[model samples]
Target chain A: MDVSDILAAHEAKQKAIVVEKDIPLEVDAGFLTVTDLNPIDVESYNEDLEDYLLNTARDGVQTLIASLFQLPVTPSEDGPVAKLPAPTTLLPRAKPLPKPKPLTKWEQFAKTKGISHSKKDKKVWDEEKQDWVDRWGWKGANKATEVQWLTEVPKNADVDFDPSAQARKARKERMAKNEKQYQQNLARAQQAAGSASSSTPNATSNVQRKRELDKTLATTRISTASMGKFDKKLDGEKKLRGVKRKFEPAEVSSSTEKSHNLAILSKLDREPSAKKAKSGGDDVLNVRKAVRFASKGKGSAALARQSGGGKGKKGKR
Target chain B: MSTFRAFILTTTVILAMLRTIKPKNARSKRALEAREPKEVEDPRTVIFVKGTHAGEKVDHAMKELMALKRPHAISFSKKNTVRPFEDATSLEFWSQKNDASMFVLGQSTKKRPDGMTFVRMYDSRVLDMCEVGVEGWKSMQEFKTAKATPGHKPLLHFASDLFDTHPRLQQLKSLLLDFFNGEIIDSICLKGIEYVISITAGPLPDSPSTSSELPKVHIRAYTTRFLSSGTRVPRVELTPMGPSIDLTLRRHQDPDPELLKQALRRPKLKKQDIEKGLGNKKKMRNLEVDEMGDLRGRVHLAKQDLGKLQTRKMKGLKTSRDDADESDESDEDEGQVRRKRRKV
Candidate 1:
């Protein structure tokens, strides 16, 4: 290889190995290479150049004015003020049209038929008089048929007049006939009973008469005062007042009386005998009396009798 | 010998041994993978048999059972006979022939005025019968199974009678638990039904320590039915009836106790403290603190300025320079008037 070729090869190797620090420059170079520019026609190019020069000069003037006054510059030819229409005076109000009258059904039909005459005028036109007559209160040709009750009444009408009165009269007659028949049956039954009782003499007739009496008694109403005694047999006998019995007092043990005596004697320092007698003498005496009474098997009989007497007196009161 | 050299030699020998052993393991694993794609077994079949005295109730129950859509379940009617055992044996023979895992025998008798339906569910696997007498208009029973037997649990859905008034439901529940060999869990799911007993092959789902453990068998018992208006006989009606027992296997999960308790507990309403602003005017006037005082002073100054502007004459300002000031003053007056009207 030649020296220049060797030097070029070494430079190429060094460039490939070295990293590029300017990323934007490299990207711009790559973009420039990748993009293709087409040439415009001479006439269009001249027109675009002229328009760009004019717009730049105009925009520069607008921007200078905006910066000087600190206000936005109004664009020429199509500004807001130029586009808006000039204000004009308000117009006078117009008068409202008159309302038309509502037509009746007959009048509406006449109008549809292209007739000019009113319904009243047609009804008033009298041919005999040769002028419009006052048709007020005058019936039309179909006036008689207009009244719903004007039809003929048919014969043999199904309407029943005073039905309630007729029914009441029939009911009254039925009740009177029933009452007369009931009276006649009662009289016949009484006569038959009297004849049978007079003719029969057998014992069976007597039994039959007794049965008839029993049946009549069963049907008879009993008084409320006698109702209590009606079922007396079903109820048991009434209980009598219970007798009051006396109970014998239990005998007091001697050990308890001795302990009581000892307790009383211990408390007495000056006179032991008097203290013992005063404190526990009554209890010991009562115990001896209870034992004597219990041995006889009839203790407190007198007390029981006294209580019973008092109870009897209270009951009497 | 040096420790490093010995360590290197041991490691090389171990690596060489592993290299030789890995191919055999790989070959065996490949064979297992090839054989793992065999077809899974189909779910067991259910057999439904109608008893001799089965009437409209049995037909209704049969329709409800069919609606459950148990895998390959079939129904058949038997000759009228009083012996339930004979009928059961015949049903068993037919079920065995058909390869059915469970049989539901329905017998309704006229002996009970409330129209009691005697339902006996026979499990071929356990060789046991779970008999339930459904009485009254709204008697319902629900049976749920966990992952034990796929077709063993009878499917009963949309039955009209769903109330748990029948005394025999308890007996039926015990029989079912015995057949499944599962622990019972009392559930407070519905009214009148005492339990939501679960039969799980694994640990109980409700136990605190083992709650994370999944249940293999879950049986839920409850009654649910639709309501109807009018006095028409509830019988022969195609309305929703239940006392349904759902049997699910492997789908049982632990229910949140706290959430359930919160749901069951009555809600406490917060008492609203309505500030009527009765003392607001006094509070507004007595602004002693710095933050409120500054705001109050500003308000007072604004009020005084408004009063002064209201009393001042508009004709006093006549200079052209004061034209802008006059306009601003007028705008402020208008704004103050608007604010006063809004306050009023």
Candidate 2:
């Protein structure tokens, strides 16, 4: 059998077998269709017909017919097409642009123009306006220049002028004129230099001396006042120590008297005759003298008043 | 009445006669040109004339200077004044380089970011301290009643008498205004003053070039701040280019918005996006890539094959010529789109 017939028969048997086996018959339909159409020319037949039908079908019946028949059922094309012929119009054609004018030779040469002067001849140009400028001093090319002096000129003045001799003569005259001026300047400068050094030294010394005096005077005044304060304090301390020492003498006298009284009492207890003699006339006489002196002493009050006045004056100082 | 009319007519005639009688050579340009090269003292020099004290009136100073009948040439600085702390040699060098004029009198004023202004006046010779009226301060402390505590050395102060005078003070104030106002026209005048000074002083070869001078002016402000223990260092730089002075302070305790607006304040820093790191981190980071650099192999390969079919495209096109042609058409459209985007 031919390949198409064999493929189709195999697809039909497969569908029947699918039905018998309780599988869906639609599942084998795609396979059966492919096998049946394998030998047909797909490009010529429009194989996308199914896709078009699926896209366009609105009614259920139309969809079923489109699917069964496998016919294209898409929407109509949007518009009809056409072409128009090319048109032309009258217009001016573009023209080539003109070239710019070239710079002149004179203009180019003027940029490099120079002015020169030599021992033989001199040529000065007017740089601003480029041209062969007349040397205000130039007479003619053959004759000597106007700057060339006429005085003391040689027969061939143009060729024989000696600039060195003229220069030397000028220098000699200048030196002679300047000689006096130079000497005056030298004297003035020497005087100024000497005065400057001397005055500077004197000014510096004066300032230094003044500074030294001021420093010494300030220090002396300060130290003297400070020393005075110190001396006063030392005198005060000495006076206080002297008063304490004087009080010590009085205490010693009082202690000595107490010791003597104790010794007399012990002697009286040991010897009756000694005690009687000691207690008798002389002892009584001393006691009476003591009482009398004590009674008459208004002098001590006067002395104490005098001493208080002195202590008060010391306190004030 | 006739006599009165005659009197008026006579007077008119006399005036007309006077008008017609001018010196014969006065109107000639050649006459004037001949005298032009003669070194004559500038009659217009206005120095201190009346009620003169030191530093009070520039006019007064000029008048005083003119009395000497000295044939002095004047040059102006691009700035009103220069600081003493600035290297003299370098400044002279820059001034000469820029073809700046030099003068006997030189001055400079610096405006701090905080809006405080400091002015410095200079001279080739030591100025008479008492003559100038203000005792020159060697250090900042000498600034009278200064908010910032100054150090030990006394700073120079402008003559109080000068400041007190209405006209003198007004002129100085106006000068300050011009400076803060950013008047570019004044730059020539400033430089002219320097030039005149240099010419008068004779030749100084060490003058700095204009290019060098400009950068120095800009950089000096920075270096000057570094030397000072001033507060509030700038976070951004504002390059101001205008005729008006940028009066705004970069730092202040309490910012005055009106002042800032008047001063024409602008920020100098540009914020760069941090998210750029995240977006390009993984894909390109492995090569430690610099996208700006040339990629030789990728460029060569891309440029070499014009109609090469991609592997994915081969499968997708089903090995068909029409499909390949359609893909190429899409590619060309994409290329056009890319070119347009690139232009944007």
Candidate 3:
């Protein structure tokens, strides 16, 4: 039997499966991507860029498919599915890196003094309780003096001196001072960021600063007991321009507005929170309904008096 | 009198909404502050506004776009009495109130019928705006098919050289990219990619390109299917998902150079990244990230003579006592032969 014809056919079949290229394709199976870094044949590319691009894309996809077929697979509902590993490509963060927080007053001082920081834990060991508890808060270590039953008094101390009350007053003052400093630091940091970011548009940033300052001033002015309406007008204190409120015209014929209102009503009707509030809670029985049923529509007052009388009778028994 | 009363009835519900802008209480203040800019930014919220004379087509197109943009979208179904081209103060007001940075305004005036403007805001001010006229559209509702989950990041495919070459088309491409840009993710799962939006341009005229208007832009959405093709590798196919639209470029505005520069600014790279050869022009020697993103390195050593290297001791290969002297002589002769040939 002649095997030459069979050998030629086998050779042609092998050639169809094999891929020949100068540079090997880099297959990232995790990402399902294949990158071919081989230099382009400039003559063919210059002839027709679109056709060249298409051929290159086809080659890449073909390589990717070949690599994918070699991967280990598990039987899935749809068929055998090759599970893709987590992608290894490093993507740049979409937003800009966060700016470091501006140093607090104490932090700045410590820096100048070349002092290293050591963090203080929020919880501290209490010797009396023999357990860890909050350093400050309800029944905290800081308020130990205020809650103590007994206290040592100085020989020269006045009779009216209440040590517990005095300790509480001191703690409140410290808290208020810390809050004031925190607000100051926040304002300073915002100003720095605003100026730093808007360096190119110096004039616009300045305008923004002026506007922010005016807003703060207005808020502070109206924050008084009189709401700034009855306050004495200071010299050259320009009037604060408030946001104007404009309503739609009375004779408006637009169907859009009507439809919009209807939409809002429908949305509210569908709201779970509003429904829950109206029904108090679906999980619990309605007290009003229970009272009406128990008293045969006598109302909650009758139920309340009956419950109180029942409690009194139980105590006596 | 009845019409006047009707206006009051309509205004009351929206009046409650308007009151929410200033943050009357602590809870409102907290809610408003949640929209503040973060270090890693959240996806931008978008507001859709309807013009006084918006047509049915314009409204439906906006509605379908809104469907894709939900969870971060706010809709104003009312007819807004504002022209963006003339006065952008109204848009600014809406942006500030909602803390939204993007807007899709649909209007159909007699002068510019079937128009849709995309207004983008930066720092609560109008940065750049562009308007496109709607030629025709097919809403998502019409297509009864499996749809992509709302707010999923979509793969955008631009199918024309004009998108890269033509200025107007380039701007349109940029606008569309920004509009569809969702959460930033480093890696995506194969199955997670549910849909892709393909944008193609109409044919350009052969002559007098400058005088003629730019070609129409066709936007089509498709769902991807990975069919098992007898092998481990699956065959991919695209099925049509709807909300297909055709747009022609209209009035456009370029962003300010200074503002654009500020917007494009990138943070400084970390020292570790630079050492890994991820810098512009200062790559470290003998380092590379492999295809799997693993760091690969090369090492160098001083050259050595292979003949002088030690080998495992063996009874048969070891030289005898008398052969050792002969072997040393032969080694010297072999070394001298090379030098002798050089002298010759």
**Which model scores highest in DockQ?**
3
**TM-score (0 to 1) for chain A, all models?**
0.14, 0.13, 0.41
Q: Interface RMSD of the predictions, in order shown?
A: 46.1, 45.0, 7.7
Candidate 1 residues lying further than 4 Å off, grouped into runs, are A1-317, B1-44, B77-82, B86-88, B110-126, B137-171, B174-344
DockQ of the candidate models in sequence: 0.00, 0.00, 0.04
Write model 3 residue lDDT over B230-305, tens digit each, in one string.
Answer: 4435554566687888888889877777766665554565665565665365887888766576777888888998
Give the winner by lDDT: 1 or 2.
1
TM-score of candidate 3 chain B vs. the reference? 0.74
TM-score of each prediction: 0.18, 0.15, 0.57
- B1-344 in candidate 2: lDDT tens per residue? 99889768865764564343334675665643432312211111111112111133333333323322223223231333433233233333332232221222322113221122222111111111111111111211222321211111111111112222334232332222222111111011100110000000001123565222110000001000011112111111111111111121121122134432422322221122112232222332223223554322222233547367455534355556565567798776776688799789
Score residue B176 of candidate 1 by CA lDDT: 40
Model 1 Cα interface RMS deviation (Å): 46.1
Model 1 error, position A261 (Å): 99
lDDT of 2 by residue, A1-317 (tens): 56998777766644422212121111111111100101112243246532322211111112111122232222335321111111111111111122222323333455467433235335555444454554433343222232345546557666756755665576557668778666765676666566566755766866888889766644544466343233334232322211111123534677798998899999765645655565546643455445446545435554455556455344221
- Classified by CAPRI criteria, candidate 1 counts as incorrect
**Index of the highest-TM-score prediction:** 3
lDDT of the candidates, in the order given = 0.36, 0.29, 0.70
The digit string of per-residue lDDT tens for model 3 on A78-132 reads 4556655433332222233455779988899999999999998999999889999
In candidate 3, how many Å is residue A213 off?
24
